[model samples]
Target: MFSYNSALMKHKKIHKGEKEFICLQCGKRYRRRIDLAYHVRIHTGEKPFKCLVCGKTFCFKSSLTSHERLHRREKPFGCLECGKNFSQNIHLACHMRIHTGEKPFKCLECGNRFGQSRTLANHMKIHTGEKPFRCLQCGKSFRQTANLSSHMRIHTGEKPFKCLQCGKSFRQRGHLASHVRTHTGEKPFSCLECGKSFSRGSNLARHMQSHRGEKPFKCSHCGKSFCERSKLRTRQQIHPG
Candidate 1:
């Protein structure tokens, strides 16, 4: 019943970016008058669409329609690579990047790539030293949100990373690797000063600081000092006099 000539004319009009529907209240324009009317309800808080099953209300009919699909267990969008189903097309599009390795989001300063815009925004915080994500366990903060999520596990005593060799669980991959080196006697980090090697860089750094007599750790109470901060705290607790 649709004419080819009429369809072509409609396509041309759409390409021209014509604003036929204009909102009288805010002077905002839309392609369709129904969409403009739906947007105007945001300012009025006029929820016209109501759900019968759960008694949920929505301002727009389209939102109510999408909400109804949740009860029906309908997933219209399916990922071609993983066969994973998504309720919305936007989620499906984002999932596709995992297979394609297409990083559209890029950091302006560091030129680092990310699949999501939010990840790229978070990466920028590292350069700025903005610790937005905080750990409730030790009151420690990190620039990245993922680091905060990982830090929360420390409070919960959740060691998710497991080693297959010894069937041991660790809070972090670095900790697990250091534990494995102890079993294997693998000292990867070498000290240039004493020709002594350590399994971890942290141990080597601590050992080197002892050789240099670099007692950076200071006591808050009586101006006492130690090579390590933990040693200073321990000494302070023992000799409070």
Candidate 2:
């Protein structure tokens, strides 16, 4: 009866947030020492979870379970709005925000909202003018670490994105998208005044400035006005000639 009572007490203690187990090896205490013992195995890379289907071993049972799901193709959690399913509940929760228009993550600096906290944190740098990520090659700075990583490829001359239509390679996806538009001749953005269409939004915005007479870029030499910076350069070249 004492052994049975001890076993029941040990089980109840975990539920009641009791740290009964202490590791002699690391001097770490755990509520259920079994959990501490299991964690210690992580440092040693001791994987006990074995898959019966393929005889594969995993460091954790949860990892093994996720791996098993991949083999089974079982996606129990699904987005009700889009019919897109996910293996995890957290992923489904994130996906649901797209349909519900829920932006819980907000930038404190500019009040910019994002679906994810990491994205909001990244956006906040734009308001603060903080570029933490720097390129080693050109000393150029970027707001996001991914942008710095992508810029490093410029030094290496690595063009990962390739146009399937023209066989041209580009460093950025936006550049690839613009190149592909040239092949398709799809000008989605159009000027309201002239009805002239452009493949890119920035190009359309620059075109609209022509009708509005908006010269955002001014020449430093003579303060000459021009719709686009390229046109301003052309005017500057004529001055030299």
Candidate 3:
């Protein structure tokens, strides 16, 4: 037999699916009045919690605690799979999906899935044809802000990713990772049919096309089929000459 405290009894409402406190602004329900008060601050834009180290303000105390970890260079959460440390537990949880290859978030517009909700949100913009991020230099728009950032790097000629093996640097991390594979001789992507391996997935895809003799791309003007886009372009050049 166990005795229930009145304070503990109040929290039991959450498990019972009782959300008594409702927000006046968004009509979002909360189990407790204190939780509702915190939610109300979001609409009011009231950041009561302030970081002493960086003077950064957060709406919630938990957010302030997370921000403090960045200033302190403290990573409380560690991924058991890869031994990677993260400042927040949510980040570690997201990182685990990379090892597990678990893509939980799926797009309703298309059957395409993503490891994270943010990636799914970015993918949805492709179907909607919404380009929120615009480059001021060329007036070019992108569906994702990250793509715009990468485009800006091309204009700026900023190569942030540097290789440890050689002094070679790349504008993108993906490019750097591929370049590093040249030094390591790591060919992770392999063909299941021939057991042939390639450094890049694109190369493996092209290799598979050779095995199948699949001429997918056809020249629009000549109607001549080619195994690759470059081959089709080459055929067009011959016609023009």
Q: All candidates' TM-scores? A: 0.50, 0.65, 0.80
True-vs-predicted CA distance for residue 136, candidate 2, Å: 3.2
lDDT of 3 at 175: 93
| lDDT, each prediction | 0.85, 0.85, 0.90
Judged by lDDT against the true structure, how good is candidate 3? 0.90
* Worst 10-residue lDDT window, candidate 1: 1-10
Instruction: Give residue 226's lDDT in candidate 2 (0 to 100).
Output: 85
- Candidate 3 per-residue lDDT, tens place, 4-50, comes to 68667776876899898999887899888888988898899999999
Model 1: CA > 4 A from native: 1-16, 20-28, 40-76, 160-241
lDDT of 1 at 58: 98
Highest-TM-score candidate: 3
Look at candidate 3 and give me any clashing residue pairs: none
Best by lDDT: 3
The weakest ten consecutive residues by lDDT in model 2 span 232-241
